[model samples]
Target: MDAYDLHSGNGNNLSGYANAQIDGIISALAVSADPAERARLLAEAAPVLWDEMPTLPLYRQQRTLLMSTKMYAVSRNPTRWGAGWNMDRWALAR
Candidate 1:
């Protein structure tokens, strides 16, 4: 909920939304060491976040890759570096 957090928005929250409850929840999550408490805080925040709809994106990021079945050692990097990150290790199938 970084986008929803008032302090953590980092310009990602296009709507400029702010919620005290959400902010408190996120703050608690940050310092919370107990797994159960963290889980509860997250669970409590879900409904509030959904109902708020602070900044819903019009499009989700989708990564697409096309590879031949005959190809082997194809790198499937999912980051912005792209799939050819390990090109040096790539080789064709026998």
Candidate 2:
């Protein structure tokens, strides 16, 4: 398991142990049916999880743009999965 851990860690050099910890947490959450239990585990593990310094936040993206005037409407539903789905609906600018 240590070898796997080392390889996985190296493969995800940007996130360090974050990926592993998230995987573990997800797996634990999946197996746990109770919301309270899942919340408890997340609360207990969150601080310790960051102790490994698996990931670092370099900068934050304050704003983003699509850059289109032709399109009559372009909006994303946060509940939806992917962002790029309606490129065909965009119209050319006159």
Candidate 3:
């Protein structure tokens, strides 16, 4: 589970949920019209926000499993653009 601490200015009272950091981040991001400002707020709040009391972080989980027989090459890097991406290929034994 992912979580973040909350601050009074971040607004954790309205939701009534014990953990509402994701809401706070969305609210902060929504309040800003500028892309740079939105990014700035996200970066600033990431360290101190979560689902307890004041801050909350949205939880994201990535899962993967692989099976192969003759495959000899595969890439699992998330940043790769083409076949090197997580979906590209899988290593297998011949």
Candidate 3 regions exceeding 4 Å error are 1-26, 50-94
The lDDT, on a scale of 0 to 1, for candidate 2 is 0.55
Q: Which of the numbered candidates is closest to the native, going by highest TM-score?
A: 1
**Count of clashes in candidate 3:** 10
lDDT of each: 0.72, 0.55, 0.51
**Model 3, range 1-94, lDDT digits (tens) per residue?**
2222222233534443443455567567657789999888778665655323342436655656354646666645443234446544555575
Give the true-structure RMSD of model 3: 9.5
Error of 1 at 79 (Å): 12
Better of 1 and 2 by lDDT: 1
Where does candidate 2 stray beyond 4 Å?
1-23, 59-94
Q: Write the per-residue lDDT of candidate 1 for residues 1-94, one digit (tens) a residue.
A: 3433343444655566778788788778778899999889989988987887766758765667788887778867855557788889877787
Candidate numbers sorted by TM-score from highest down: 1, 2, 3
Stretches off by above 4 angstroms in model 1 are 1-12, 57-94
